[model samples]
Target: ILHVTLTERRKEYEKAKERDAELRNLRDTAKLQEFFLQEIQLGELWLARGEHKKSIEHLTNAIAVCTDPNKLIEVLEDTLPPHVFEMLVHSIPYTLQV
Candidate 1:
């Protein structure tokens, strides 16, 4: 079920990218959101696959683009197990503290 949801989100991300290109002159939050969503989805997928390093990479990317750390934390809490979230926090300690 999660895989299916992720796949659907991936499709939405692709479409969003196309729309972003077409509306390049416009300043929109959708682009950032799409990138964030994609990164988070990839991070979760890697986590589920036991690829902690790759998961951290994608999660870091997501964090880099995020405007709200608290919101990101909320999403992470909902999506990732507590231990995995702790690992991610430790991996990017400085970034999270910022």
Candidate 2:
């Protein structure tokens, strides 16, 4: 009976470990997307500095990942820096039309 209990506990531990690994992968994916958002935010800085070409490129890519541009703009607005929000907001109307 003791041996059986130990085997069950080991199985539970292995399952927990597997869950942790999956969670880690999910966390990494979130981090990568956050990095992309940061890039978009940085593009706002470029626009402020009159680097329109690079700014549009980065913003375009960011909007592409956004399945719902309107919803995404709303959700991301408060989280982003003010100028970044400005740029995203400015671009959103055009994206909706497209």
How far off is model 1, as Cα RMSD?
Answer: 16.5
Question: What tens digits encode model 2's per-residue C-alpha lDDT throughout 1-98?
Answer: 99999999999999999999999999987986896688678667777787766676567566766656556566666665676567666775675566
Span of 10 residues, lowest total lDDT, candidate 1 = 89-98
Candidate 1 lDDT at 16 equals: 99
Could you tell me every candidate's TM-score relative to the true structure? 0.58, 0.51
Top candidate, metric lDDT: 1
**Model 2 per-residue lDDT at 98:** 68
lDDT of 1 by residue, 28-73 (tens): 6777889889998999899989998889889988987888866887
So what's the TM-score on candidate 2?
Answer: 0.51
